[model samples]
Target: MDEVEVVVAHSERATLRVGDVFLKVDGDRARAGVEARAMALAPVPTPEVLWHRPPVLAIAALPGRALAQLGRPSTASPAAWAAAGAAIRTLHDAPLPPWPGRSADDLAAALDVECAWLVADGVLPRDLVARNRRIAEAALRPWTPVFVHGDLQPSHVFVEGERVTGVIDWSEAARGDALFDLALLTLGHREHLGDVLAGYGTGPDLDRDVIRGWWVLRSLLTVRWLAEHGFDPAAPGCEIDVLRARL
Candidate 1:
């Protein structure tokens, strides 16, 4: 029998790997349903859904390794990073999903709440949080909705050589800002932003400041959640460092 390997485990969800299959156990069955639906709708490659029952969805593993991991330098080549960007562009260009994403007001409110908690709890320095909050303001504006993977983290993207194989983790999938996906993809891997933009083909139209804002916003919003979920957001090159970089 193949030994079960825990890929990720948190209060909201957990993923376990048994041989070539991944079983995602989510507390919210609706999110699982959305993940499966998003994977089906995504034009890019996604893991084949073997079966889905409430709380547990089984999927076959993809062909290649993750594009990168947070807090670790990526070993993927520039071309591979570009490939990821291309894949993301394709997804964004797809037809919008049925559901809506968080609005600017909602995001701003959440940011306000999180920032106050961070300061009141002494989780991070007020100056650091304040500066990043200022930077994050740029992203809390109206955007043309696109078919976003929502949580397009580097680790969700998989590649083989210079080719993108598949992107995983679609629970956060929704119609949102295209830059949010781009920002998340290059969060800790800023060195690859040029390569990604090259493939995304945004040329002079890309708003780099907005992307920068998202980096700060995403980091700030996720830090406490990460800590609560048993993740070290303060690790080098991770969420805290990303926020600190804005300082």
Candidate 2:
């Protein structure tokens, strides 16, 4: 069998081929609908997922591009940023799952378990798991968390042109503040500060600064991710500086 990813089975039919089966996504049969505004600019097409297998997952084949292959521009085009901001809002606005019976610690432990390999490799996190455990201690305003694409790293976002064609690999979706999404975006494009936040509609009240902080934190936090994953930290060039600048 040809293994496409370390986790993916190589069988052409994909059914019952995976080592740890999860949900099948394309099976949802959900359409993009009018919510399709910003998705038109990507190079890859987001075909409706044909099925979803639960817990772990299988979806229709993606356009077959790796996230690393899409080199970053100094900034996304203005139009692209606008679309991204809108796409984020739409995702945030979607209905979320009910709070799981677990506490915030349970959530952190979940991440730690999934990332055990990376952590064992020496990737240090921003105490996110710890932080979540103590969110009740923070003095920040209390807003109910909403559904967030927990792992919005560049690796999860698919692009074609100025638009994001498909966003998959949602093993970490959760209920959280929207800043989590913005944080991931801002970290991905530190130099494109304006492009990352442009055209974001906050309606009346939103903390732009907090969003920016999370942006910086995401970059710092990812260093831990890369290092733990057995990637050469220095090979990326400026990995330490990148982490230092934000951390």
Candidate 3:
């Protein structure tokens, strides 16, 4: 009998791996729909969608290990990180997905709500949250939206040697700020950012300050969510570390 491996399970969704196939079960069917559409539209490599029914999507596993994992040192070489950056450029340059991503106002509202919760729960000091929130304001400015991998974490990228084999998890893919993806990709692994940017090719929009702003905003917004979902955003070299770095 094949062993059923639970890749991850949270209140909203769960993923399981069995041999070479992976299954994703989402509570919201619209997210799955967006994922399927985005995967079809993406120019870069993504997992092969084997089948999909309401609430459940099955995909064939990619050929390589993740580029990196949260809170752990990345074993992938700088070239692999650069390859991942190149893949992101390809995706961002592709035609925009039909759906819209979170707007600046939406992000502001989320930041407010998340900060309130964090302060009220005493998870972080008000001063820390306030300072980070102030720094996060820079990223709220407008820009031309591009195709963004809404949650482009290192673990979502699969790399073989120095090449990126595929990117996974398209549920959050949409038309949004490109810098947000870049920021998320390099969140904790700041050292590899040079490689990432080297392959990304610099532009006026790739502002380091704004990218750092997004880092603060992203870390602030996700800490409570991570805590609720049994993840420790405060772990060394993780989201909380990203937040504290602003000081």
Candidate 4:
């Protein structure tokens, strides 16, 4: 009897700290559309630290499967992928404050916060983030700024036929480097990269250096997170490969 609480994680696989709460938590499962899901979490209001605790009741599992569970790649068509990109762009350039937009100031600020975290953990260099800041700023220098999905991947996309059913998951949402989302497709569906970006009106001429740099950032930060929990992400060769290609 292993412990579990959620049955159906739903279209949007959000993090939840459900069940009986301690003053250290924010009620049950910090989410909507879920009930009786035991999500072990840390102090709400701010995720300082966390621990997993089983709940007395389990939220009824939803009637669906995660793309990861299917053991197959996404069925989202080129058109659907492009459509998601368009929608995510809107989220990026949102006029509301408390977020980043497609602007030099926005890019620098976002990079500063993210890079500082990586540097503090000794996973990357200060100059690395600085270089990215410059690239993102320049990439948009000639074009109208459009915010892009901070994180984009097959798993974050759900489709039914040529239509995109859902584009969930916003934890990494940000407002810079729209092309970075396309880069995700390159890694996930390299063969379709041309088609995917083409639908975005750019036609497959992605900036190799900048996209590769962002990939490196993902690898570095992800590997560091894994290492903190006593797991090594199969050496750093994958990261080195991307970096070398850019040189």
Could you arrange the candidates by TM-score from highest to lowest? 1, 3, 2, 4
Candidate 2 lDDT tens digits, 1-247 = 5343443222211223333232332222222211122223222344344443332234454543333211344333566655566666777776664432223455345445534533464554545334432332221344457656666655555555566666654434556767667656555455544554564575544566555545434443445545555544444323444444443
lDDT of 1 by residue, 108-145 (tens): 99999999999999999999889899999999887888
Candidate closer to the true structure by lDDT (higher is better), 2 or 3:
3
* Superposed Cα deviation of residue 87, candidate 3 (Å): 0.8
Q: How far is candidate 3 from the true structure (C-alpha RMSD, Å)?
A: 0.9
11, model 3: CA deviation in Å? 1.2
Write the candidate numbers in order of decreasing lDDT: 1, 3, 2, 4
- Each model's number of backbone clashes? 0, 21, 0, 6
Q: lDDT for model 4, on a 0 to 1 scale?
A: 0.43
Q: What TM-score goes with each of the models?
A: 0.98, 0.57, 0.98, 0.48
In model 2, how large is the Cα lDDT of residue 186?
51
Tens digits of per-residue lDDT for model 3, 1-247: 7799999999999999999999999999999888888888899999999999979999999998999998899999999999888888888888888788889999999989999998999988999999999999999999799999999999999999998888899999988999999999999988898899888887888899998998889999999889999988989999989888889
lDDT of 1 at 56: 96
Better of 2 and 3 by TM-score: 3
Q: Worst lDDT window (10 residues) for model 1?
A: 197-206
Residues forming the 10-long window of minimal summed lDDT in candidate 2: 30-39
In model 4, the runs with Cα more than 4 Å from the true position are: 1-98, 101-145, 203-209, 229-232, 235-247
Q: How far does residue 197 in candidate 1 sit from its true spot (Å)? A: 0.7
Query: Model 3 TM-score?
Result: 0.98
User: On a 0 to 1 TM-score scale, where does candidate 1 land against the true structure?
Assistant: 0.98
Give all candidates' CA lDDT scores.
Answer: 0.93, 0.46, 0.91, 0.43
